[model samples]
Target: MKETPSANKSPPKDDPRIDALIRGYAHLSEQVEVLTEQVKIQKHQVDDLTVDAILAEFHQKQERKTHADSPTPYGRTPPEPAEKEEAPKHLQPEKPHRKRQGLKLAGNIVFYSALVFLIISALFIRTTSNGSPRSLAGFTGMVVLSGSMQAEIPKGSLVIAQQVDPKTLQIGDDITFMANPTTTVTHRIIGIIEDYEDTGQRAFQTQGIMNDEPDAQPVPAVNVVGKVIFHSEVLGQIAGFMGQYWLFILFAAAVVIGLTVILKRIYQKEPKQTAH
Candidate 1:
């Protein structure tokens, strides 16, 4: 018996083309999710120099969406348009403008505050008694000027040394002491000499960490300043520079004041532009 025309027709097997199309759509959806996350991240970068990059990314996404919706030769229907949406709170024109204006105003306050801070800090760094930067909280800040304790304490590093009793000091303890009436050097105490010449002064043998030979003379205990407690490497360099050129520090302060005045005028104009 011969089969009818309807019986001759076979049911459609699973189509590889359909599977590929589904997979492509799934990949596209993942890419869109990743891009959306990236957009969220970039929105918070307004304070940096990347605001233009964020705008560029937004435009690129718009272009991609436009292209994805274009008609194709595969007889597939174009994607439907997304529903119209009110702007997200962060994306609203008015909110970001207000935030930007607030930031601009804050920048002026910050600049002036920093300028005042530098002036006060430079003055303190320039004044010193017995090689100590300043005495506060029973600690004296001292700036390192030599490579004697290189890599660890480092050249141009600042150390805060606290004044401690000579009896409390021990061999191998780092200390700052006056080598002469006008000179001070910081080194580790290698030897402690007691009862010297009935002068009631303890004697210490000291050596720099990087120096092969000990100091030319022993330091008297009365000259000892303190023990190293805290330090900053880069800040010490800035203090050293200001100490050598205090006049430059004042000139810089004046320049900052002038710039702050100019920026103040600019930020004051932002609100007017957005008033409408």
Candidate 2:
């Protein structure tokens, strides 16, 4: 049968429904990308604000305490007792100051004792651990004297290195050893360069970052102290701030206590019943 021309007509060149659907999808995808970037920036700003608030609160409290303990602002002295109306000197006592001093001494003792106990426990565990020796011969602390290893190891970092035989060290292994008795160095082993010396013994050299040239001389196995075993981020800060300001430790302790209390309260709270 032959169909009519109207029946054989094609669909419209532009359908409004199809165009609307395509536009909707493109708008949704663009909105999602923009929202994701916004969320990242907001999270970073929140973290920075939180730290700033905490530090500011701590300093403000400290300043208030300092002002309270200070003398009168006007420096006006209290009237002295008249000679005939004098009160007995023995009646007054320095009890308040003595009590405060005693409390401070006790708090300091407790704080130091706790810190020492923690340090001792850590040291004991390290000494008893496997693959670690107790002797200083193969284990010692090395002060970073140069910035050659600035990325991996910065200057002033106390590295605990273990003395290892040169034959045992492999390429890509990070190690610290004495290039000479007077000087020690820590660097990654890029490769082992061996050469026969006049004495017919194998001489080894060490290379490090930021050095335009290889080590001036070979490092003897005997000069090695040990490889780094552990590192503490706080230890360096504490060492650097020794006898300068002790209040930071107290602030840290307070923050920890507050967080612990908050967690406990949250965990102990009863769940609310949802109405049906």
Which candidate number would show the highest lDDT if scored against the true structure? Answer: 1
lDDT of 1 by residue, 150-189 (tens): 8568988877688898888899888987676655577988
TM-score of each: 0.47, 0.36
Per-residue error at 266 for model 1, in Å? 9.9
lDDT of 1: 0.76
Least lDDT summed over 10 consecutive residues: which range in candidate 1? 124-133
After best superposition, candidate 2 residue 3: deviation in angstroms? Answer: 99
Where model 2 places Cα greater than 4 Å from the true spot, the runs are 1-137, 193-203, 231-234, 239-276
Candidate 2 lDDT by residue in tens digits, 79-197: 33334664677886657888999997998688667765344333322322343323444465434557787677777665666666667777666676656444557776665655445
Error (Å) of candidate 1 at residue 262 is: 8.9
